[model samples]
Target: MQGDSRAFEAVIKSTERLVGQIVGRMIGNAEDRKDIIQDIYLNTFKHLPGFRHAARLSTWIGHIAYNTCLNFLEKRRLILPGENFLPEEEENAQASNAIESLIAHKQLTAILSEKLALLPPVYRTLIVLFHQEAMSYSEIGEITSLPEGTVKSYLFRARKQLKEHVLTAYKKDEL
Candidate 1:
């Protein structure tokens, strides 16, 4: 994320899929997802200097993505009680089964999204960075300004919440 525009473009190209998935899960609509993705890129550029090598580039960009989505939600007053976003179409799914499969997928995604959204923004940010982006707790702490222990606690609670939600959904589906 330096020097040549090509480098920046490369970074975006590599990370766009992950960023879009994360933002799409947070913001839902295609139009808003695109807007939030653009905002993430812009913020990444603006904050690149302050991004010390304390965390992975992916984690750093993820921090930017989370903050950008929060700002967008705040600006629009769209922050719902729980995760209110929709999942994007899975590109690999076949046309015939797409609708059904997407619905099932969306249900799971929505459960996870709701649990994630219920967390405080700081913990939500940590969960996204650690689980979604596959960053280490230390790296997440670096990006979030939290202690490593606190990051671990947040992740633990996040996982517990997600587990409870999935279990509840599974039980409902069984009935």
Candidate 2:
């Protein structure tokens, strides 16, 4: 965003959907997600001067989004319960089928989120920078101050963890 408030507003408007999705997935409550989104915008505006334009603007904003969500959850003393943040509805057979589908998606997402959280902050940040934000390994190394080899290793480990979790979950479902 430029120094202009209108420009910043435009950026927020354009990115709110993405920001909301990230925040919603992390926090899982509509009101809390909105609060977290506002916090992210405020943090972005506050830290705008420190932004060196070394990364894509979206990547920069995404970094802010991730941190904001984490901080909010931390402040609220929340634990990342291993449940998919599916919409609440009554339990009927059709609803059960829908819930299963939603839970399957949520389970995968939750497992990845939990595994990523288990990683050290540096590894987690790099994994998100590379996978979630689609940054190049070199770019992640630059952003994270890690070697490219380290970035690759961390990504490999993270992906392996995700694979194991998903496979185990699938097997449990099958039984």
Candidate 3:
């Protein structure tokens, strides 16, 4: 039992960042994030014994995290926004203007982050797993339980959305 606990600890330590990234991108609320993360790890530990070595350990854990976040979102009745959904509250377009200025000031990374936050949870997850984690389409599909084609399609759409936002938000010189 001691050895089991130690192994589980190692797993948690190694995958902490990946889990953080997954939960962070999916969940906008900090308090909900904390509860969801705890629930994720608890689920991971509870099911660890049954885990087959069919997938990489990180991938398996990531799968759990992804599903957990989806469940959380579903329970809250909060659907991920598609292209037509406007953000719930924005007093004006200052946020957009601020992003543009951030781009003009050579803060491209920050500007991109702001835009990323506006994306739907699934799109953000795809971007994080594919770009930030450098996971291949197959691996992402496994974690996301999406077909490879769907993963590719979603990723392409996410990138396109981001591109459009960047282009329309600022003049070419700003970039």
The candidate scoring highest on TM-score is 3
Q: Score every model by TM-score.
A: 0.62, 0.55, 0.83
Residue 27, model 2: Cα distance from true site in angstroms:
3.5
Reference-based lDDT, each prediction? 0.65, 0.62, 0.83
lDDT tens digits, residue span 1-175, model 1: 4655788898898888667755765675789888778888987887777878876787678667766776777787764323542222333323233333434655666667766665445455566766777777777665555688878876776665555445544546656
| Model 3 score (lDDT) | 0.83
lDDT by residue (tens digit), candidate 2, 5-87: 99889879876755654565566577877777888898888888888988866657766787777677678766532222222
Give lDDT tens digits, candidate 3, residues 12-102. Answer: 9999989999999999999999999999999999888888899999999999999999999888877564534433442345334555444
Flag regions of model 2 displaced more than 4 Å: 1-3, 13-25, 73-132, 141-150
Best by lDDT: 3
**Stretches > 4 Å off in candidate 3:** 1-3, 81-104, 171-175
Among all windows of ten consecutive residues in candidate 3, which has the lowest summed lDDT?
A: 83-92
Worst lDDT run of 10 residues, candidate 1, spans 86-95
Residue 12, candidate 2: alpha-carbon lDDT? 90
